[model samples]
Target: MIESISKASAVSGTKATESFSSLFEAPAATLEGTGATALNGETFMSALGNVAMQAANNLKRGEEVSFDGLTGKANTREVVDAVMQAEQSLQTAIAFRDKIVNAYLEITKMQI
Candidate 1:
């Protein structure tokens, strides 16, 4: 029974990761008028903005779901999913920040 439960949980986790990934795939219709029809057409600044917005939204969702869970309005699975997504977003943002800081330091060390 325990093995079956663990397997089921693993499958669900895989599905959640897939769904999360799909959220970042902008539909062609939405990109049509923005001049970013292709993935490469997106500018760095716009991509950064989109990532920031997504992170903010994920954290917000986690908070909301947590509150709902406390009030008995949300199920455990939903709360867990939201929190996991928010944590992933935060870690990604932190990683981005670290890379930017390292790049700045590297630039500072370069000779004029």
Candidate 2:
């Protein structure tokens, strides 16, 4: 799922130079209590959910492949591919979740 993000600036006449760190940092808080924003929580969760679902579906396909007989409705390559895809998707989702949780914990430790 693509999240629509819009950016605007009021630079006078020069180009702007920004680093990648700017993308990850949360906005500074102010007096109005409106600056504590989540860092792509919805998008990240959506992506993680999608990958997990795909992994589960792939595993089901692998099981189906086995049940369908190796010569009738499925082949060895198909089963192998399905299993590999499921494994890779599961690994990726785990890694992403770990990274996000680690980032949140690190931010919580900041001297703010």
TM-score of each: 0.64, 0.48
lDDT of 1 by residue, 11-65 (tens): 4347674674465667677778788666666645457667876777788889899
- Which one is best on lDDT? 1
TM-score of 2: 0.48
lDDT score for candidate 2 against the true structure = 0.55
- Error in Å for residue 94 of model 2: 1.4
List candidate 2 segments past 4 Å from native.
1-45, 69-72
Clashes of each: 0, 0
Worst 10 residues of 2 by lDDT: 1-10
State candidate 1's TM-score.
0.64
